[model samples]
Target: MTSAQICIMIAIIVYLIGMIYIGFRCSKKNNSTDDFYLGGRKLGPFVTAMSAEASDMSSWLLMGLPGVAYLTGISDAGWTAIGLAAGTYINWLIVAKRIRRYTHTCNNSITIPSFFSNRYRDEKKMLQVIAAIFIVIFFIPYTASGFAACGKLFSSLFGVKYLTAMIISAIVIVAYTTLGGFLAASTTDFIQSIIMSVALIVVLIFGVETAGGIGAVIHNASELPGYLSMTLSYDVNTGKAAPYSALTIVSTAAWGLGYFGMPHILLRFMAIEDEKKLKLSRRVATIWVVISLFVAVFIGVIGYTMSKVGALEMLTGSNSETIIVKISALLSQHGVIFALLAGVILAGILASTMSTSDSQLLAASSAVSSDILGAFRKDSSNKNGSMAAARITLLVISVVAAFIARNPDSSVFAIVSFAWAGFGAAFGPVVLFSLFWKRTNKWGALAGMVCGGSMVFIWKYLIRPLGGIWNIYELLPAFLIACAAIVIVSLLTPKPSKEIEEEFDRVAQMK
Candidate 1:
């Protein structure tokens, strides 16, 4: 291999080794199911904040968002980023503290499903089963998207086969997650978050210089129809800017709604060592998110400028997702040291993928082992058994996700979006109601989950295809429907028991 290739490989290998070492270090802490699943509620503010956002952003931040800007221009990606930033802030402000206190109040529930089950005191365990089932169903595809991104990254960079690269990525993620569980995942995620932010800023700065500076980049993009407009997109066929309707903008912004229901993110809120520290966490997370997102979007704009000026070849379709990788590869042409830095940036892609996948895998495993299987076992003190079950489930789910990722042609953005909608619509309304609405009974919670989850499929497949007004994203409509179902159903049913009402009031008043 060339010196440049060797440098890149060594850098990546070092990053991977560091992650494995963290897993080993944290493995000793996994003495109980609580420790494995929720890190025993001991994460500090910065780790909680950075790890949550890192897992939330995933490879889509680097690959998918840039690809959209590279292909369609600023409208789609910019609005989506705005929506996510709003969601992140809102979720931290409203949901973080309440959920943290409520989970502790409600039998110290560790997983989302268990929290729901404990919150409503569901004797039948129906809520737990349903929530677990939904997690597995949605998270498989979500995890697969990360694996698919790894395949794309390795194949484009190292000339490795897609399947082989994907398998390697999957194995490493499974190793760390299975070994250290929540603590390991969160710690590694914090490190990855830093890497991701640095990579975005560094690549953007260099990419702009390579594209002949900011003025030239803007001028080149301005030449493309609707390339800079938030209310329009470029129509390649007609070679003109096409109007981006208000409905589309609203639909795209609805992505924020998904933050409410994401299991992995919610777990971070629950795991934070102190609720007061969340304020600090929120500020740190938001600042990082804003900076990182701005740089990521600009990287795409820079890629377009580079392509337009013949500095880089234009890519289309799924291949367009490689624009960031292409830009990083170009940095290698400068020198060995630059090539090594490029490898670190490339490792940032892996960092994004692994950080998210490990969280997803861990969440899915907890849903299965802690929520589903543990509910069935009469003996609840089998900590070792539960830990084993969790590891086994992680392995099984990772294998399934890898198999799904073997398609080699999946769009990372599309796949992540569908699963995002599923979690958002299905659980978002239910989670909000459970925390804030004192009258929200088990019946209402169950109804909300069922309605919200079902509506996503119905709207996406049946109604969305009809176009026109129905073209709005499924998450918004489904979210509304789910909220309505919960309120209407709760009013129709008997009021929650006095004990449940008192608990809600206590949590509401919690500091």
Candidate 2:
């Protein structure tokens, strides 16, 4: 490796060592499955807010969002960012406190599937089984996207074989996560959020300066037809503006709906040290998300300017996702110190990937171990036994995710979008109805999950291919269908038992 490469690598190694150390330190606290999965509901307000958003953003913030902006101009990426920002704020405002209280009230449920099963008193474990299956199915690909991002980071930076870099990165992530569990994940996530913020700021400033300042960046963007317009998308092939309809904007903004069903993010709400402190978390999370998203989208504009001025090569297709990496690589060439700074910027990418991947692994493992397998076993109450099962399940899930991520050609944004749609459709409506509608029972929840999840596949593969108005995002249709199913199924079925209704009232009435 060259001197710059060596410096950058050294900086990354130091960051990884710190993360692993935090993991090792936190591992001692996980004496039971509750601690492992929910951090014993002991997260402070700042940690809760930062960890939740950090895990939610993932590598998509650094790679996928900017890639879209770089490829199609701000219209596509901007609307998606707006949807996500609105979703993040609303999820925290509406869902965080209630779900935290409700999950705790429901037999102190530790996982989303368990929360559903417990809320409805589902003795048959149908919710657990179906929800667990869905978690495994959807989350594997979500987690795989992170692994793919890491692989892309390594492959592009050091010219290593993609699979080899991916496996090594996976091992590092799995090591810290398996050792420390939820508390570790949350603690590291808080730190990673800071790193992510720093990385974004560093890159945005560096990129703008290299592109001949903010004015130049804006000028370059304005020169491209429809590139700066929120209502029109730039068509790269035709080199012209394409019509962006109202329906398309709505479909793209539907990304916000995904927050309701995000198990990992919800776990942060549930894990807070005190429900009263969620107000602080909400404000912290909302402000950070809004600012970070704006910076990420603007970076794409700067990247295009850099390309125009010959500071970087023109990147197309999946390669556009590496625009941030290209900027960091340029920063590295300035000298050893700048190279080290570039490494820190690159570490931010890893932080984004690892933060989300750890939470995802924990959620998927909890579904399999605590909700699925634990329901069948008489010794489910055994803390050590549950802990062992959860850890083993985590390992198994990581292996599966790594395998799924083996293809180097996969697009990080595409995989995340599909999985996001799956979770949003399958669980979002059910969560809303269950929390707000006291009459919703097991039957409704079950129907909603199956209908919503199935509809995602049907829409994406079957209906969306029909083109024109049918080209709507799968999440929009699936989420609506799921909500409709929940309302119809709940109304048609018998009302929830008095006991369930009383508990719902108890949670709803909480200050």
Candidate 3:
């Protein structure tokens, strides 16, 4: 094997070792459901912030979005970066503190769906059921996206079959998650986040320097038609579509909105020791996001430049997803240290995938246990049962995620983006209205959930094929319609009862 190939293999081994070490360390803390799932609700500001951001960014941050920028150029990137940034910022500012306070008031609910069920007491079971369904459905695509990254990375580096890579990634993730639960997941996420951030920065610096610096890279890129344009007008090579416009970029970036309702991410805020720590968490999380995203985007830009200038291309047995790996290999050819650095880049991708995938599996399990099962039972004596349920749920969800990730049909970017829109559309509006609106009744909230979620499923899968004037992404339309349904239905229905009002007020009063 080539030295570059050897470097990648070593990097993968180092990452796996680090993950195992962290998992072992956190295993002692996994003594209870709270410790396992919410880190005993006592995580410090840095761990809380970094773990949340790392989980939120996922493989898509490293692979999918950057891949798009590499293939499509900077024009398409503007919308994605802007929209995603806006959504993430607003989610942090709006929902972070409120959900932190509200979840604590509502019996200190440990899961996203549970928070909803507890918030709107009248629809406890229904909310939990719908939530579980949505979690399982949307989560598959998200989890699959992460798995796809693993598949691509392993296939590129080790000549493993894609399916085998998927399974390997799945097993490693499930091992840590089942053994350590959320504490394991979050603690490792913090470590993985550091690795990812450092790797990105290092790769970005070297990649730009090696590619004749930023000026030459931009100049070469600008030679492509509309490469520097804010709007895109190119279609896929098949000639079946138009180039994405500037609006497409915005819509793509608005992806950050999905964070508001993401179960795994919001759980971080709830688990912080107190509301006061939220300020620190927010600052730390945002900075991590900004720096990491900047580096990821830069990596893609550099990759595209190197590819265009004859530094890399499709090999006899390789493909697009392997481009980053190949580019790293090319860097390795420059020096043994550069080859080692390439391994770091590969590990960065692994870190992003594992961090996000572990959190997703845990969140899915939490929904099944704390939200779905716990809602139907009134006896608080079932804590042990709930914990057992969560563990089982983790296993089941991981298996399902691994299975779907092995499927041959889905595209990496599309699957991830679809699930993201599903989460944003289905829960973003409902969560926002529930927190801020006084008149948001159970029925209205339920309506919002059904309409928003159904709209995404329909538009994304059903309506796209029938194809007429519909070019808008499902999230935009679903979010708008769901918000409208909440407002209109809430106005028609009775306001929240006095007790519910008191609960809301009590949550609000918790600093």
Candidate 4:
């Protein structure tokens, strides 16, 4: 390897070592699954805010969003960002404090599945079982996208086997997460969010200068047909402007809907030390998300310009997702300092994946060990074995995710989009109604989960493939279906029990 490559590798190694050290350090505090899964509800505002957003963004923010812009222009990426920014704010504004309060109020439920089961007073535990099932279903692909992103980063930048790099990334993530669980994941996410921010800023500045600055970036972008237009996309194959319909814009923007159901992100709300502090967390998270999304999208524009100026190689298809990595790789060629900065940039890519992966692993682990197995255990009072069971489940899930992500050709954006739709459709409506609608019963939540989860597959594979307007994103229709199911099912079924109703009213009154 060149000196530049060596320097970048060293910087990444140091960052990885530090992350592992944190896991080991935090492991001392995890005495039981409660601590492991929920950090004993001890997260402060800053950690809670940053960790939630960091995990939520994953590699999609750094790689996927920029890639969308790099390949298709601003229409898809911009609208999605707009949708996500609004979703982030609205979710924080309304849902965060409520769920935080409700989770604590309803038997201190630690996981989303558990919260649903606990929230509705599901006596047979069917809600928890089904919810956990969906978590595993959607989260496997979701987590795999993170692993796939890491593999792409390493293999594209260096000459290592994609599978090898993927495994190493998965192992490191599993190591830290299995060792320390929630605290380790959250702490690392908070740190990773900072790294992600720094990486974005560094790349933006260096990439812009390398590409001949902001004016040049805009000018070059404008030269391509529909490249800078929100209502059109430059079709590289046809070399013509393709109409970006209003319906398509709305469908793409519906990404915001997924925020309501994101298990890992919701857990942050539940784990916070104080509900009142969530207002502060909301502000921080919103501002950060808005700024991050803008920069991430614009980086693609900068990347396009950079390619034109010979600072970066032109990328196509899934390789477009590596735009940030390409920029960082180019940065490394400038010298030792630049190489180290490139390392930091590269680590940011890892951080984006790791931050999300660790949180997801924890969430999925809880879904199995705590929500599924723990519920079925005859001796539920035995806390001693729970942590071991949780860790084992965590390892199994990580391995499954790694295996599924073994395909180096897998598109990070495609995986994330599908998984995001799954979670949003399946859990989004259920979560909102459960928290906000006290009249919502277990039957309604169950129906909503099943309907939403099923519709995503049906729509994506069956309906959306029909071409024309049917090509709309599955999340919008699935989310709507799920919401309708919840409302219609809730009204058709018997109302919640008095005790459950009182609990909702009580939580609603919480300061």
Candidate 5:
């Protein structure tokens, strides 16, 4: 390898070692399943907020969003960011405190499935089983997308084989996660969030400067038809811009709805040391999200400008996602110090990927071991056995996710979108109603889950292909269908028991 390549590899290696060290240090706290799965509800406000957003952003922030902006201009990407930012703020404001309090009240539930099952006082464990199954189903692909990003990063930067790079990435994430569980994942995610933010700002400032400043970049982009318009899409075939409709904008913004149902993010809320601090966490998270998203979108705009000026080469189609990598590589051309900084920024890509992957892996493993397997066994209270089962399940899930990511042609954005819809539609309505609406019964929850989950598939594969208005995002339609189902079913069925209603009232009245 060249000296530049060696430097980049060393920087990445050091970062990986640091992650593993954190995991090892935290592993000593894993005496029970609660500690492993929920960090014993001991995370601080800053760590809680930063880690949650870091895991939620994933590699999509650095790669997918920028890629879309690079190819289609800011309209699509900007609306999506607006949607996500709004969602992040609203979720923290409305949902975080209640969920944290309710989870503790309901048998100290350690996982989402357990919380749902406990909330309804389900003795048969049907809700827990179904929730766990859905988590595994949706999370596998979500996790796979992160692995795919690793493959792309390595293959593009170091000339590594795609599969080989993907495997190595999977192994590193699995190692730290399996060793330390939730505590390890959250701690490292906090550090990664800082790295990701710094990388975005540094690269954005340098990229704009290289492209002849922000004014020049904006001028060049505006010259292209519809490139800067929020209400038009550029059509490559006719070399013209087409009107963007309200439906399309709504669809793009609906990405925010995904936040309510994301198990990985919700776990952060439940793990915070004190529910009162969530207000502080909310502000921190919102500020970080807004700044990071703005920088990310601009990085794509800068990449386009730099490519046009011959300072960087533009990648087309799905390959356009490498625009961030291209920008980082160009920065390395300046000198030795800049080359090392480029390596650090490249490590930011790995940070984004590993942060999300570890969370997904941990969530999936907890679903299988603590929620699924623990439900069936009489020795479910055995902390040692549960912890061992969690590690083993994590390994199995990592292998399955790695296999799914083996396809060289997979698009990170597409995979994440589908999984995002699945979770949003399936759990978002249930979570909202379960917390705020006293009328939601077990039957209603079940109906909502089924309708929401099924509608995503039906809409995406069946109705969406018909085009026209049906082309709207599946999450919006599926989410509405799920909500409607919950209301109708709950009204038709018998009211929740007095005990359930009383508990709900108690939680609602909490400060």
Candidate 6:
């Protein structure tokens, strides 16, 4: 095998060993369902923040976002990155403390579905079933995206078929997650977050230096059509630059709006110990996100500049997963240190994908076992049975997601965005209204979720079948419709019982 191949194989083996050992260590702490699902809710701010960010960012930060920046331009990078940063920061600030406090008061919800069932007093199993279904439905495509990323990485490194690579990826995820649960996943995410930060920063610095600096990059970019334009990339087919507008930039920036509703992400708030730590968690998580995103964008910019300078294209080709491989090849011309940096980059990619995928599995499992199954076995005696069902649910989800990964329709980054938008539109409005508004009844929550989620799927599948509507994003339409549905439905339905309204107020008032 080539030296690069050897390095990649060695790196993968070492990373896997570390992850497995960590999983075994974490399993020792798994004495109860809470411990398994939430790491005992004793996590400090640093671990909580980093773990949440790691789970949220995933391979999209390394692959899709960067690839878009590279293939498109710096303008696309700036808008999307800035938008995500702002949205995430607001989510951490606005939702973190409130959710953490309310989940505890609402009987220490272990999952998002549990939160809904309790919040709306969904005694009829309505919210519970709906929430669980949406979690499963939207999460399948989301989990598939992460698996696709791992598959792409494996094929690039090992010259293996995508199916074989996908199976291998699934095995690694299941092995660590099925054995260790959240503790194992969180520990590895913490370690991986550090690896990702260091590797990307090193690359950003080295790439810019090699490319002659930011001034040179901007100057080179300026001379190219639509390269420096923040509006939109020129459509070669139309042969005209699309008019740049504020609406375009705002829509791109709104990518961050999806943060509030992502099931895998909000579970972090529920896992943290108390509301007091939220301040520190927010600071740490925001810093990690900003730094990591900046590094990824920098790599894309530098990668494109290198290609413009007659370097081979790294972000494209049959082995697109090896975009970092291309960067490594370029840097290795310098010496052994650069070679080691390449190893770090590979580890970062693995870490990001694993962290994200494991959390998704956890969310799906919890939703089914605790919400859907628990709804049927209403007797309190079934708690153990419910938890056992959760474990079984995890296995099924992992297998199904792995299977789907074998036949990904698009890049991991693209699939993830669709999932993110679905979750955001469907759940974000519901959660926000439930917490802050007293009038949000079970019907309103159900309507909001159905309308938002259905609209997303319609835009994805149906809207395209008819002549395409407008250029507006699907999430924008779905989100607006969901908000309207919630307000209209809640007003139309009987007001929630006065007792339920008081209970919501009490939960909202918790420390």
TM-score of each: 0.99, 0.99, 0.93, 0.98, 0.99, 0.94
Best by lDDT: 2
Tens-digit lDDT track of model 6 for 370-483:
778777875756546655776788989888887777774555666777888899899988988877889989899999999998998887676645642444456777887899
lDDT of 1: 0.92
Residue-by-residue lDDT tens digits, candidate 4, 1-511: 9999999999999999999999999999998788999999999999999999999998888988999899888988999999999999999999999998888888888899988988988878899999999999988888888898888788877799999999998889999888888999999999999999999999999989999989999999998899989999989788788999999999989999999999999999989998889999999999999999999999999999999888788899877888998888888988999999999999998999899999888888889999999778878666778888999999999889898899998767777889899999999999999989988899889999999999999999999989888999999999999999998998998998889999999999877
The sequence of per-residue lDDT tens digits that candidate 1 reaches over residues 1-511 is: 7788888899999999999999999999989989999999999999999999999999999988998888888999899999999999999999999999999999999999999999999988999999999999889889999998888788877888999998998888888888999999999999999999878977888899989999999999999899899999987668799999998999999999999999999999999998999999999999988888877888889999999888899888767777888888888778988999989899998999899999999989888888888778899877777788889989999999999999888767787899999999999999999999999999999999999999999999999999989998899999999999999999999989999999999999876
> Candidate 4: lDDT over CA atoms?
0.91
Which residue pairs of candidate 3 clash?
79-249, 79-250, 80-249, 80-253, 83-253, 83-254, 84-253, 234-243
The parts of candidate 5 lying over 4 Å away from their true place are none
Return the TM-score for candidate 6, rounded to 2 decimals: 0.94
lDDT of 5 by residue, 1-511 (tens): 8777777888889999999999999999988989999999999999999999999999999988998888888888899999999999999999999999999999999999999999998888888989899999999888998998898899889888999999998888998999999999999999999999878988998999999999989998887788888999666566588878999999999999999999999999999998889999999999999999988888888888999999988678887788878888878777778878888999998999899999999999988988888778886666787788899999999999999999978877887899999999999999999999999999999999889999999999999999999999999999999999999999999999999999999999887
Clashes of 4: 0
Off by over 4 Å in 1: none
What is the C-alpha local distance difference test score of each model?
Answer: 0.92, 0.92, 0.77, 0.91, 0.92, 0.78
Better of 3 and 6 by TM-score: 6
Query: Against the correct fold, how does model 4 do in TM-score?
Result: 0.98
User: Which digits, one per residue and each the tens of the lDDT, describe model 2 over residues 255-363?
Assistant: 9999999999999999998999999999999999999999999999899999999999999987888898889999999998899999999999999999999999999
Model 1 lowest lDDT segment of ten: 315-324
Clash totals for all candidate models: 0, 0, 8, 0, 0, 0
In the range 1-511, model 3's lDDT, one tens digit per residue, is: 8877787688778888778777777877766677778888888888888998899887777666566666555655556666666666777788888988887778777777777778888553787778778988888668877887787778767777889888888888888888788888988999888878867777677778767899978887676665555665333353222466555654566666677677788888888886687788888877777766666666666876776667667222114445556666777787677788888888888998889999988877877776677667687576667667778888888787777778644576677678878888888888898888867988888898889889988888877677554666778778888899989998998888899998777767765
Pairwise TM-score winner, candidates 4 and 6: 4
